[model samples]
Target: MSADLTHVDTWLFDLDNTLYPVESGFMKQAEARMTQFVAKTTGLPMDEAYELQKTYFRDYGLTLHGLMEHHGVDPDEYHAIFHDISLDALAHDTDLLAALQRLPGRRLIFTNADDRHAERVLERLGLSALFDDVFHIGSFGFLPKPDPAAFDRMVEAHGMAPAATAFFEDSERNLEPAAGLGMTTVLVGAHAQDSHASFVHHRTDKLAPFLATARLKEAA
Candidate 1:
């Protein structure tokens, strides 16, 4: 509340670590699946595939992009293989629910994962009804976050005014594009503190507690 959020009319959130705690192991499973797919597709050992996966992610912003560009892999197949994770380890967080409800505006999910993957995560977290729309990687034609094109597609599709938007994400790199687009960028996660960047307008280790601060300070 003290951060001058009055101008923010749209709440744009990243799906993974931003919406749910990273300890939930949701993304860990997806990462393992990505490594497995790369290993099977390229006939490489698991260790080599995992290293390649990490490299692709770092270089291309998305492993799917690297696979498509270098390996001529089908994006759909990679998506299905990588996102085919079990939601058994995940659970609903009512605290996150209350926190989100307190934030004023049209809330939307902007993620690198496909709709199918995003749906499963939201369903598992029992947050399916909270968001207005999910702008997935498919929606951006496979371009991932941190890419200026991806952010452009989101703004065009949602008719979002970047200056009036507040974007919350776990990745500092991702926040750079959002900041350049004029969004009030908030970095979420413990790893968020491991790096320092001018793009980040706010930093919080927990989404619920930070959002709760907005509500509590309003009531005060």
Candidate 2:
């Protein structure tokens, strides 16, 4: 009935949809920006660009990766333009920030977004200082999630033991590999439905309640 944080020393949290609710229009705005970027770079129409972006995300785990592999575009430039949207469109929720601060572990943000974007979002949510560090896309040579190399690098960089870490992500596919590496996996979105690993621990729509219960259980 409560979370056990005993074996978990590092809490790896996903940014975008996991930090904030996807229902918020912030995701939509970011998607639009990505679409526009693709269109501008490829000289395609908006709808085609949007489709291409989706295709790339589906195929390569990140639109930027696909762009790099195919179009030879600069990853930094793509991130700067696509993720430079206003964080003002997102609603403030400090309750989650408080919960994150109270969580019993070294908290780190593991996101596919660039560092600038991650910094902006965390700052807007008043959670910038709560985290030990942020592992952005740029951190691991633009290697995104679902890539074992990226996860491995994150573990090594943070000096974390795979068995003593828990990864909270929005994507089931991403969590699957982390689970395989012996990390407890918490799926934090509707899209994360199927996973073959028992280490895939919790599935929650929101993180605040989960964190509160986990903290209470730890106290008890």
Candidate 3:
């Protein structure tokens, strides 16, 4: 069944792999940076650091969160270093830009990355003007997605009605709380096919096409 978007007045999107295709290697660069940061800070070998980075990401929603919790890492310092990656891999996605422009109402970015990283990515993709605002990890007090409390704060801060909002994310785990809060959840990317979670309202391998052909509720 197709999702009815007529009732959706607010569109929330995740950054990174959600907005851009994972094949672009943008996240690959970021992950490499994470590994380097971990190696430098923890004084571990590159391979061991990479493994630890993944462990932190798996245990904590964001690697930064894990570093903060265990290593008492300076959040600002870590953020600045982690996001210092090249955006050369990303290109302006005109199709996505056009699709976003066609959608009615508020369009916002809900990302685990900081606003600086989000801004740079959006700029690189030529989507800087489409979104109304960005709700980054800093906005959630360093609490990343999948944390129900972070979702609560976002909804409250934005003054959004859950039922009237649609959240598009690449991570199925992160979408769980959005669905639980009554927002329509759309899982994006190739991983969507692997999601067996009943909470996912829609699945699309690509976001531009989904938005292009969305079935909107009829105007009453």
- Tell me which residue pairs clash in candidate 3: 6-217
**Steric collisions counted per model:** 0, 0, 1
Highest-lDDT candidate? 3
* Decreasing TM-score order of the candidates: 3, 1, 2
**Higher-TM-score candidate of 1 and 2:** 1
**TM-score of each prediction:** 0.93, 0.91, 0.95
Off by over 4 Å in 1: 82-84, 215-220
| 1-220 per-residue lDDT for model 2 (tens digits) | 7777667777899988898888777888888889988999899999999999999999989999999999999987887775557777666687886777676768899999998889889888878888989999988888888889999899889889888888888787788789889998888865544554565787777788777677332431
* Residue pairs with clashing backbones, model 1: none
Local lDDT at 174 for model 2: 86
Q: Candidate 3 on 1-220: residue-level lDDT in tens? A: 5557988988999998999988788888788888988999899999999999889888888899888998888878887975668888999878888788888888889998988899888988999988999999999999988889989999998999999999999899999999999999999998787888999989999999898778755321
Please name the candidate that would achieve the greatest TM-score relative to the true structure.
3
For model 3, the run of ten residues with the poorest summed lDDT: 211-220
lDDT of each: 0.86, 0.83, 0.88
Native-vs-model 2 lDDT? 0.83
